[model samples]
Target: MKAVLIIVLIIFTSLSSGKKFRWCTLSDLEQRKCAELSKTLTAVLPVTSIDSFARISCIRAHNTYDCIDKIRVNKADAASLDAGDVYSAVKLYGLTVVAKEIYEQGNCVFAVAVAKRGTLDIQRLRGVRSCHNGARWTSGWNIPLGFLLARNDLSWDEAQPLSQVISEYFNASCIPGVGVAAPQLCALCQGQKSYVRDKNHFCETSSNEPFYDSDGAFRCLKDGVADVAFLDHLAIMEATESEQQEYELLCPDGTTAELSKYNTCNLGKGPGRGIITRHNFQKITNKFLTMIQRLFGRKGKERARFELFNSSSFGGKNLLFRDATQHLQLLEEQLEIAYVLGLDYVALLKGLGHEGSSLDNRVVRWCCISNAELRKCEEWALSVKSDPLVCVQGTSMVNCIEMIKSSEADAVSLDATHVYIAGKCGLVPVAAECYGQVCAPADEITEEMRNLHLKHKGLSPVYAIALAKKNAKQINIHNLRGRRSCHSHLYSPGGWLLLSRYTVGALENVTENCDVGSAYQNYFWKGCMPGADGNLCKVCIGDSEVEGARVSSRCAASHNEHYYGNMGALRCLVGNPSGRSFGDVAFLEHSNLLWNIENLKSSGWAKGYTAVDFELLCPDGTRAAVTEWAGCNLGPIPPSTVMTRPVTVTKIYDFLMKSQEFLGSKLDSEFHLFQSQKYGENDLLFKDATQYLVPATHMSYQEILGEPFFQLAESVFNCTPAAWNHVQQHPPVHITHSTELGSAVLIACNGGFIIFLGSSRVNALD
Candidate 1:
């Protein structure tokens, strides 16, 4: 059944989780401005193990899930008291030691408590009845765990479960501490045992009704049953006002002293709070610096920035300003140029020579269509000309030319920037926008790299299979001979080459014996290496290969805007907040996660790929003086917009319902366009746009192309009409209109992007 559960009570800010108490420490009590600044502000409840207090306020505040905002829960600290809180701090777990210390010192203390009625030390009752909430209490759990173990000389497993202990106390043992209720029991411990008759002492409904309790141990002390009550500093402060009037101080070793029941307390520190936003923290770092200056003067501001330094301010999302290596990469490729008003007016191009040379390899294509690490060779070399144009901003012509001329590639490609740079270099401005795109470091195949692909014409699968069979027969002969197989293992490369040939000759076709299988994924990390123990077992290749996925890209967090965004961008889906009962806590982590999934994901139909904006970095720290687009594929993300969470089988069902139409549409469109044209009609194909689809209904190539399409096809370019040579070739990204190739949709069986134009039934999506 479909379900929508509204469980927002688990989320909220730490401060307003409950009514103010008095047993809190002096510093803590001061921050609890419930008296002087008593403004009832509504906030989303943060996810908490015990969020009853915050839940009450949230239900009363907005009352509806849609209107709720600003979550209030304990700050996420990896060292905090709960596993749930630690998990929520996902990325925040990397904060430095000092930051962790500060966070601990604040609200979410790392300490727990030991309580008996209200008195902490229950030494008098060696075997008394003890009962209270389980270890769910941060303070109640931690303090007591440590304190009780030391005093009783016992470990956790050595201790009995509460129910069992209570049972034994009544029947077998004589322990004094018993029952988990606070106020009713605390009243008895504090000297007011009469309150045990009332149920209100343990309830949150009405304080006047006895069960209308405030703080757990505080009530135990209030009712006069216990001597000492323990709680975290934040909880202690928010619940009370008599700062020092509560409990007496205890030693770090857990020994307690008798004093006022609500006076002094012991506590540990925790990490503190800060602001969160979606923009790249570095780009607006200057603005952040200014904000700090205004808020805390210079030193405090600087310190604040320092505090946030390693906390996502400059991590995985941008150019490596934080990491020295990344900083160096940028320094290596930057080009500084200025555009004059009118002097520079021609396009400057990076002259990567056209295809066919060895040195002409475009190691990194700045024009990444939401992808990087140029796939297999050839295509990798011609990546420079992928994108059409880029305009560089510059100061003066002289400055621009110096920046442009000094670049690693050809002249900076721009209508004006190149004009000035070329002028400075004495190379007069030629034509602008005439040539589609210019490439540099013209490809020149080197002998060595070429040797890697040169076919020595090794044994084909067919020949190998025949020999393998013969070899397996010998292995069977040995087994049938009943001779034991030896297990000793040791071999040098020279020995292995000699031994391998024999082994291959013998076991290659062990398939005849039903024992043939691949070692490792058959490639990549060559099967296990030999060691003293033996030859490491190579991984067996299964039915799968290295998977490829594409998701929203954080590869460019500096720029959140996706270019040419279209319907495909809808692939992004907002996630349902968990742990947080509060509806309004906007976790940029969650939101950004969603944003990236959507921004980078597109159906095959949504060729709306995005690329990163980058300047060239050269080997020498000087600007390669190049600027262009680049892409980084952020592996497969949520298949559907609704899958804001990680991939799940259930989520796939929903994604398909919404995005099925895009399947095979790109190839289908090519087919339909080729089919739809009637002779003599104006051509629908336009060079300006990469995507072409009929408006009303989807059509196939066979269904669309007619006499008009054939006539239209003839007017534009000559179609080499030599019986359509139908052979698969690699991607035609660098497919040149050479005399030998003719006008054909060359497809390569081994290429990354599968092309299915000529095939009658096949379809391509990658």
Candidate 2:
């Protein structure tokens, strides 16, 4: 009887104690609010029968991180954390999100850079005074700074603190909580700094600091203490009408937009605060939160007595949850923290020194074409230590694309034309090469500028020009019929597609069902359109002479042919070493035009020709200096892009961005990433004129190619019966088919064919 009585008493004690859910509180005000919440919940429990409704108890912690630790150790059941802290909590503490704080804008918020209208240029933010909500905060520090780091506007050596990098990037900043780690960043702060030790509140992450949060940061900008303010979109939305009218958002693309357009014109978007609990404790915590929110949420039955989201009575902003939060949304699905925070946002945070889970240890297999590119790839493989790269050689660029699509290779850099074909093959662009002025100025390039260039280089537009010798007076855009031409390669955007759009398409009125290759073959009497057969190869001067003195590599699509890329096309127009000109006009990208001329001159191919000797054939039947390509060109072209499978896009981008940091410098003596002279070739692996590789993970092939250029590509690839017959006869290495109506059919006369039919899509892999 005594043993049974003792066992019953112990059982009752355990049940009652375990039924109490402890809530983590970071400050006194939060603890007070949590106590009130506990009382209100207990008061409402008598009216309901929720089995998981445990009596609430407040557990005090030092800070958010402490709260995370306390909850992880099971001392506390749950706590609300910002997106950044949520990443840390889930990543480091192995906690799980049970519910999210839903604001009026849903579960995510936009981080925006705001400056006085017409007062600042988004691209040139270096050395400017800036305001941030607080150190390590999401919209204030992490998002904005991470954006700069991701774009290459700020360079960081992972060994050093990120605060140091920010201090050097900006002249002064009002970043609360930076403290003494970076005093200079707090130079523009309005926090108290009295001689009395306790009175000093400079850069404190509290109300004591004048510029402590989003509202304070905005005030700093308005007071003219800071040139720009980095804060969440809600703060901007809450600003007075006149204040909104006085400022505009600085978009990451180097453009400015009105305040109302924050959705598209912000640094980046990220998840909102979420309620997290110990990994397996989500079931009970979720039910507990659901019950409390039901009674105190936006439309709670007892909201008039005690509001869950509102913190005014607690004497703090966003105490238990953001005051802006409307309700708590239960997240029932098991989700990876990265999925909740977003991959881009996670990448940004990872770049900003918030280390997360380890990166995949798999090596990236880079696809290479030709012996020269293989050698360069081999050397590059040895250069990068973090992301190991291995070389996989293919017979040609198209073959490389096939290899990548078949999982035999991981990545390859291709011109705009090939990028389109790759996209059709289910590959995506991870990065793009920026040439000339679009990149950071080589002479004045700083780490910050390099980073900025890496971020915005994809937006840089390329131009196509119709190049003809100054002596060819009759070779204007109008009288080019039957003239010998030198094209970069078949299906090349600037050389073939844009040229055909202006010349053949315009003259023949071939809107639909057009055979662009046949049209070019018939239009040009004799020409070297690399990758094409018959008459197109007649004018080609191959790499060298064979035993019978026959041109060995005539009209080949790669650098093995003497007349292949933009430089090679220029070489064709400049004539052979014996001064035997092969063509009257050349079509190619305007990038490095002057450099190509000088290179040829130095190589003795154009012994006495100067840049002035070349002229641009204007579309209006006029001729202008080559430098006037802006006013006299075929059309704007997109830059070259690095292609990879969708699953490997982020992995490839991370590798390339790191590679650029280590090897992109022209000053790097071991192996210059952009120079190919040592390989005895031009544009191997990547374009020789490339200044740097920019991240293109967020872009699609259409976005990278731009709407106009993409449309032009579509028109060029809309094959007619003749073109289809030509493709069948050539019988390329592989054939890809798409079922969707109006899908593009990209054909490479010498390499492969992509046919779109009104049937199921198929990949005819060899």
lDDT values, one for every candidate: 0.21, 0.71
Q: Candidate 1, residues 194-236: lDDT per residue as tens digits? A: 4544322222211122211114344554455444444433334
Q: What is the lDDT for 272 in model 1? A: 18
Which has the greatest TM-score?
Answer: 2
- List candidate 2 segments past 4 Å from native: 1-19, 47-53, 115-125, 150-152, 157-159, 177-180, 186-210, 219-227, 245-248, 251-261, 313-316, 356-376, 382-639, 642-704, 710-766
- For each of the candidates, the C-alpha root-mean-square deviation to the true structure, in angstroms, is 32.4, 14.0
Tens-place lDDT per residue, model 2, 228-250, is: 99988777776778987899999
Candidate 2 residue pairs in clash (backbone atoms < 3 Å): 151-451, 152-451, 152-452, 153-451, 153-452
